[model samples]
Target: MDKNELDKRIADLQAERERLTGELDKARTEARDAMIAGQKPGGTAAALAERLSIVDDALAELQDRTRSAADSAERNNRKRRAESALEATSKRSKLAAAVDEALNALASSWDAYADALRKDVGQVSGAGGDLTAVERALTNNRAAEPLVKALIQSGGVKLARTFGIDTPIRERHAISLADAENRVAESLRVELLRVKAESPQPNVSREAQAELEKMETAR
Candidate 1:
């Protein structure tokens, strides 16, 4: 049996022993009271003693078995943990390799990238986002998982910089997925309001536009 099962059995045996002990004590008291009063006792003190002894023997044997089971269970648990850690580490390496492969493939497809860049009319600027929480989370495994995942999925060329795998993404954004989503949404709404104000369409009624303005004001 497993350690937990063994422990439960041990607990049950101990409970039974406690119950028997209480009964045995009451039996002895009754027998003593009857002898003092010069009458036959109703108590079965000998039978109770024999039952208690049997329980004691069983409890002792089960406790010894549990000690060995506990050690074996602990060893097996650690073994699984060690094996799982190796697999996790291997997968981590594979993930990094996959990212690198994607980067290399992108570099190979340079003509499309050049065309997109040349056609881009957007202004260039740094994101200047705060990285305080991300930096702090690095030392903590539980906290870092989601943070690192969000950073990778945020879709920047210099994700390596966030984890110190490469240089800093200077003049570039180092934002998590949630923050990136918020920024994209906010930027789009602002542009929508500006366009609606500049050239009011038939569909963009005054009341609808007022709600957008209200949202801006609330923020």
Candidate 2:
């Protein structure tokens, strides 16, 4: 049962008691009117007393029923309150469990992201030695000059355009590659740390704790 249902029951009982009281008052009034009417002929005091006694007894019975209804209403109200409290506690416990799962998932995702960043940085760094060797090979061969110049011109133009650099061809290529590599490394490090920092910590809401206590009491 819920509070609203209990309140409705109490209201119905009160209304019924009021109706019974009204009926009892009406009965007493009718008895008095009868005695008054009887006074005209054979209006014996004994007859009047008997009619009044019956009215009194009926009124007492109605009063007893009214009292019994009030007591039942009070008991229902107490039961409803206890049930409502128990339900609220159960809901809160379920909510807390959901929150705990969400936090654990978030932490797991952050850890995975950090691991991926570390792998990406390692792959990029492994290419650094190979890139340096290519630069050295281009620098030392004069007989291979035309081929090197053609390669530089074609690659430099594309690299410069892609990187948004407007410098001399050789300088632009070198600067763009170094800058891109450094930026990737730095970005990976920063993002990994940010994910670690944003990971959820252990904590619980006060309302959730209170609800848990209520559930324990019910058990």
Candidate 3:
């Protein structure tokens, strides 16, 4: 090919390499922002992989064009430009991988925190009931005041402190006291069963020995 034609091809490859480098930079920035914003696990990794694929394609094209260019100063400049683009792409890929790992860790932390909160709140609310039920039960005059106080404090004193309410007791009514006590007992029973089932231990003799012996004989 003519010198002029070779120079034009080299220039085109150089421009394409620069464009790909810019795209890699943009992708790395986006991935970093997503990590800071606490994106879900694997999202950043997928994005980084996509950007790396583009970089690989552009690098291959740059290499082919550089090899076909005529031996001259223009060819040397294009080769240097290709090398710089490859280096930038490599750096951005590493940065993207780091960001993805960080975001995944953050997502795991958030999930663990949420799960713990759910368990804590569930303990206070009891089965088949909401926080309001627990609050009303605590208002009953018949309810054990110490137990009620512990429940309120366990749910975080900040809630009561924020609303300027008493730590142990809120507004109480005499008429609903009996009903509240009954509801509280039922809720506590259900919660106790749930806890027991979650951590059950073997009790070999809880049932009648005759029935156990019969079952053993049958086996």
Highest TM-score scorer:
1
List, residue by residue over 1-219, the lDDT tens digit for candidate 1. 666887888799899889989999999999999999998987498888999899889888888888777788789999999999999999999998998997687556434533443343132112232333333333433434324445555644456465464433432445554564365456556666656766556566565578677887988
Q: If ranked by TM-score, best first, what sequence of candidates would result?
A: 1, 2, 3
Colliding pairs, model 1: none
Steric overlap count per candidate: 0, 0, 0
For each candidate in the order shown, give its overall lDDT on alpha carbons: 0.64, 0.53, 0.55
Q: What tens digits encode model 3's per-residue C-alpha lDDT throughout 1-219?
A: 555665676577567657666766777677788779997444554655576677567657655655665346677899899999999999999999997997698469645644554565555554554344334333335543433443344444554455454554642322233344455565565455545445545342333344444545866
Q: What is the lDDT of residue 77 in candidate 3?
A: 93
Score every model by TM-score: 0.35, 0.30, 0.25
The C-alpha RMSD in Å for every predicted model, in order, reads 16.6, 27.0, 29.8
Residue 58 of model 2: what lDDT?
A: 56
Colliding pairs, model 3: none
Residue 106 displacement in candidate 2 (angstroms): 2.3
Q: 1-219 in candidate 2: lDDT tens per residue?
A: 344554555565566556556665666677677768884333344454555566556556555666777788899999999999999999999999997897698469645644554465446445432223123222332322222333445565564455354444363334332343455555455444444445563233444445455545866
The Cα error of candidate 2 at residue 117, in Å, is 2.8
Instruction: Summing lDDT over every window of 10 consecutive residues in candidate 2, give the lowest-scoring window.
Output: 129-138
- Whole-model alpha-carbon lDDT for candidate 2: 0.53
Error in Å for residue 99 of model 3: 0.7
